[model samples]
Target: MPLIVLCGLPGSGKSRRAEELREALSAESGGERRVFLVAEVAAGEGGGGGRAALRAEAERLLSRRDVVIVDAGNELKSFRYELYCLSKHTGTPHCLLLCPGGAPRPDRPPLEAPDSRNRWDWPLFTAPEDPSEPLPLPEIRAALFERRPPPPNQSTRSQPLQAAGFLHQLDRLTQDMVAALMAAQRNGVGPGQVIPLAVEGLGQEPPGLLLSRAVSLAELSRLRRQFLSYAKMHPGEGEENLPQLGSMFVQYLNSNLL
Candidate 1:
């Protein structure tokens, strides 16, 4: 069984997808292989860089199960590499599911780079003057407000727009993922691979837009109609836009077997 790692930003629906993967894998196993899910937060690990406990739990789960799913915002290159190392040490096949997380909203401030925040085991995006120090707010503000900072190598450079920046983050994340997975595969991890799965509208609505308290039935109907109209306009993009977790797992297994 392959150790599947769910990587995405916050509110990216990784948890739900992880649960889906766990259930799907369990069903496919038919009581023969145990499926375990280890969440980074629930592991009670203290803070960023405190993944030892989480890693230990994953190792233990792997020992008892045929599949282990790691649910976390593995946005940093280093963290993904660490998982690769863990798979190598434990002798388990590893595959990464990279969720593009949802679309960005224009109203909110751009999300700080995952590395900019020290909340998780992510590598920091630091200034060139001091690699350990985060880029100053002035630099970040210049990038975000001025709409451009500098070139790629410039530590202060940011994406042209928030959406562009998020996409860029995904690009960098996927690149690192491929590098790590390739290394793992070379070292004998079974089909160490990366899959891009997008779950649309994970956290698009704000509290005011939620259905329970404020939203009326008429408003909901309008939203539904709007969605239907949009879908009709792009009929070819049907449900095929993103494969379900179960279908993806099945495809992975089948490909490996072949």
Candidate 2:
């Protein structure tokens, strides 16, 4: 299924465009494909912010057999890129549909228009301000069908784990992922920052462990305790099980933390 991120500001009519795109996509796919229009950021299973929730929802939906339309202002270039990386990592074709001429909001970051030169923003479309105007359906379909988006090639910022990937290796026989992640927090990495399992360049920086949102210190502390307790019971011997343990713990955290 394809992923479409609707970009604009508070009053840019992203929701309406999202519905319009959803309907069009369903119709074009003859109702065979389920189209999801996300009007609001979903409440997270664990903890994080609204953006993290949206990312979580998108990741969940993208994993299944459905098309996703994210109806958010997506005001920051960084956020948009995050979605792009997720889609790529998931082997999902994605595009950016921008709604121009949106009313600006002082409370939000200024919108960063999608750049044609950037590969992630390719297959990008702009929704006309007029509600009656038609969306770029054919082009979008072509983009989705033309070819599968290449598998994630590099660890991008929004893709977090390139820098914060110590999670899978978190409980490496010699390394303490929790302590390192906490150290990252101590170094001023806050909510929504890439969560490094270790400090910069210290451990294996794989491409997938990301907290993606804000969790309270109490919550993290509790979660750490839970992981540590579990580790004590079944500490596997040798280095062969490092990945398995790290992966299991990461899954546990993602399941519980968000």
Give the number of the best model, judged by lDDT.
Answer: 2
Candidate 2: lDDT over CA atoms? 0.65
List model 2 lDDT by residue over 93-165, tens digit each.
Answer: 8889998876886655567678876565777888888988888788888887677766544432243432233
Per-prediction TM-score? 0.39, 0.58
For all candidates, what are the clash counts? Answer: 0, 1
lDDT of 1 by residue, 66-152 (tens): 777788665544344445445544544555655544544442223333332221222222223322333243432332233321122
Error of 1 at 224 (Å): 54
Candidate 1 clashes: the total is: 0
lDDT of each: 0.44, 0.65
Instruction: Pull out the clashing pairs in model 2.
Output: 164-196
